[model samples]
Target: MTELSLIRNFSIIAHIDHGKSTLADRLIQVTGGMTERELKEQVLDNMDIERERGITIKAQTVRLDYTASDGKTYELNLMDTPGHVDFAYEVSRSLAACEGALLVVDAAQGVEAQTLANVYQSIEHDHEIVPVINKIDLPAAEPEKVKAEIEEVIGLDASDAVMTSAKSGIGIEEVLEAIVQRIPPPQGDRDKPLKAMLVDSWYDPYLGVVILVRVMDGVMKKGQQIKFMQGGTVHLVDRVGCMRPKIEQLPELGPGEIGFITAQIKEVEQAKVGDTITLAKGGATEALPGYKEVQSVVFCGLFPVDAADFEKLRESIGKLRLNDASFTFEMENSAALGFGFRCGFLGLLHLEIIQERLTREYDLDLITTAPSVVYRLTMTDGSTQELHNPADMPDPVKIDTMEEPWIKATIYTPDEHLGSILKLCQDRRGIQLDLTYVGGRAQVVYELPLNEVVFDFYDRLKSISRGYASFDYEQIGLREGDLVMMNILVNNEPVDALSMVVHRSQADPRGRALCERLKDLIPRHMFKIPIQAAIGAKVIARETISAMRKDVTAKCYGGDISRKKKLLEKQKEGKKRMREYGNVSIPQEAFIAALRMGDE
Candidate 1:
């Protein structure tokens, strides 16, 4: 077993595509953790979606043995974390398992919104941070400017920061030396009662459910009985293992070391993330602090394109939920969409990842509805309720005030596009609280309604900023706003999944835009269809879709007036029957397309 002083647990965090995974690959290669034949680009990002999108969707941990210049071999447990704001909870869990962090910043892009947000999160955890200026080999790289910004913006001393190009393998040795020299070794007593934190967990087909944990106090060994502090469920440890890129069975995991353990657990909920694990015989009296239960912020309805696949979709989601505990779903019935599930996610990117996984992994065709934010509903009887779906909201005339969740948004962008970015933010009902310049870029802070930004806010921000802006947001509690539920009615019938909560000031314009967009998407039926956007019983916007014309007089061309009149009467009778009994068949694409009205 390695001494505690020779073990260093750290995580690599940065903005998306800022060379985090690339640097991780370089580190893994440098330490001989994986041979050339075994090494691949973004090796830590095992998910196909992660490699295709060039983003880390999940937190990955690996153990590396490196011989430092000091003639000492150290056990380095490097945890790579997702950079998107949606995965902040996952990032925090990763940070809790580390003693230090390498804050990677792109030399060309300098400091981004996520970079600063993650740096602050690291600071809050009191983790020793080593700022690394990456991509120095690029033609546009400005290491000096980036180094200065790190000091000025992040308030970290950058003079000692390692400047490296992960692609070119430059400064790889320097980074390894820095990790050994600068980052403190883990400090914990091995004689204490067993205390470990379950940072992450996933389901394995053969091994059942496996959990990645950081041993904080005592040793964890195979055959030992353990109990989850929060869950109060006990189990016998079937295996104790370490991640040598892949899980390798370990006889025991000592204090300050990271590894995985399975106790024959089958359900993912049994081994909860951020929960404490201790020996069942003699465990610590109190659980660890900073345990956070993951909650979903944005919600949407997910339905199978084929009605017969409802049960299949449910089974697929159940399997997925075993691996992803953050996502939540419950059965829902829709008027337009048959049977489906109302799913909740962390954010937009998270929602996309799950959808992509369901499609690719489970081979399911799905139709997703517009996203909605959780709202607080207060009634006249001094009662309160939380509404996630718009259809679940109470009546507007509930005799009391309604409040919607608000967010504190922080955006970092180039100075040249500051005006347009701020204008876009204001248009989204953002209240600008402050604006400051970091280096040559602008850092703008605003308090905006969460409902406003949960949909197309990120895309719009990227558009107006010319794709040079980075955004991060956090909930700032609920605030009373002029909120209303806008519903889309096809042929004067409301589609529950298409209903959304929008501010009154922007409701009319948004409703009109949605109605017009849906008009082009929904195919013309045999009878005229009226697409209307309504708030309660009041129709705020309307668009008419004309029926496809088929001339009934063509067959009676110059035959006779009586024959022509008879054919016309027959057509009229058919049209009346169609209007009375024929329901509009909205394709799955139309429901999904309704959410993309602002994409163009």
Candidate 2:
């Protein structure tokens, strides 16, 4: 491409199901970047979970070549970022790769909580944002009203906004034109040391790891040695390439360009998502800036459903960790769970996707415990440790004091539902920091402990607001907070299956929720299964599962000699997954679901 027709790189960001990926598909199709049959509803959502859930999980990169209204052919590197808060770090990294972003807002829903969050993030990252009101094909869409919403809230001109129906390809060409007109071309010094941020990467068994990077500073040749900024690790490049919308490889990649690199980099850690890579010269120990290894925010305990499947689960995680080291795992030998790993995640979606992938992708039957955030635990020795799991921590008496992680949670909703949202937050121990009105909607920011509502905050918000609210949280600081180690006892023995360390104020609600879910999930075995939540010896709540009414009444079918033996064999097979506790082999989901439904 010539100087006049270089390129403009940008990302498309919006709330869940506001048509960001659909718009992406339409954009690629209009640009002839993707063929007709190759187009899917959410083309950018390439993962099975993403397609099944109808949400973008990982950030997807696509290159588009379009002739602008000005009659100039320009290369546009489009990034589709995950709409959920769990992958916020990935979203931030995606924003880093682009010079601008398409702030997609639902025409009728107006600006949602996530939309406002992205708008703020775009400004913070210094990206030139081109606001677009998508989903204008729907009869419920109010283009003029949303145009005003974008103007009043985002402080952008209404006339500048593109009213687009990405599903029907309506006015999407204008959005592309807006990208050419508003977003700036890629800026870099090609002669300088090659530098770029590894925005996204994936592992391929046949081709090793394919790296997706946007050259931010210097030229990236087909073969060059590079170093990561965070770890100072160096690797020799084998091939530098780019992907068109069809996933085809390109010849070369340079500064002011976004493309892929293959160094036979098998591990995803080598090509981490956020790390900046630069030329390895003079054995320099450092690299480019804006690189930070993400800190895991949510944690849970996991083991295989069958004790024999433990090794299978481990191997599955090992393979997954190659692509996502962010999912940290450490083995924990619990008397109740047998052997398991204390795993960490970004948030609930991250946790769920990992579990789902393990079961569906890796074909492993697994059991997971309740999710917990890091708790600042101060020991008697005047040292601090992040208490991720309550079971692993020493006694409370050994601690002088502890601070719990807190967050400044923001929830944007329609003006009519602010009262209900506030009431719901207040019940979850939220102290209102401030509330503002934007585009006839309310943006309510509150100071809340991360443990206070991490599990059920989003669910309750949707329930209270009738699915009109969206929530996002950023770690504010650690605060002097009182939290309890709420442990669950199964069969009079403390089982990690129901342990959740929650804010002290949240004990009642969390316990009640756990108990209620447990009642629905636990099978009625030969003995009554006791479900009790306690702080030490005190049982704050309790529920009893009535004993199972004889599951083997048909053990001997007509006493047909060998046929009866086969019938009994099948019966044993059916009950193979039940957890044996004093002659009751309970179903695995009862315990697993209890942990997942913690504090919800």
Best by lDDT: 1
Tens digits of lDDT, candidate 2, 1-600: 235236888998788878888888888889998788877677777688888888987788888888887787888889888878777778888888888999898887887777777778778888988888888879898988888877887787778788888878899879988999999887776566667888888887877887888886667766678777775677778776666765666555766788788776768876777887777783334455566777898888888878998888889889998777678988888776788889999887788899999989888877777677888888889888888887876787887877877888889888889998899888877899999887777889998877756666777788878877888888888897777788877666776656777677778777877877877876677556777888878888888887554455465546558876666576665544443536544467777667657334
lDDT string, candidate 1, 451-484, tens digits: 8797788898888888999999877798898788
Local accuracy by lDDT, each model: 0.90, 0.78
Per-prediction TM-score to the true structure, in the order listed:
0.95, 0.87
RMSD of 2: 7.5
Report the lDDT of model 2 for residue 569: 72
Q: Once model 1 is optimally superposed onto the true structure by TM-score, how far is the C-alpha of residue 386 displaced, in angstroms?
A: 1.6
Worst 10 residues of 2 by lDDT: 577-586
Q: How close is candidate 1 to the true structure, as a TM-score?
A: 0.95
lDDT of 2 at 361: 88
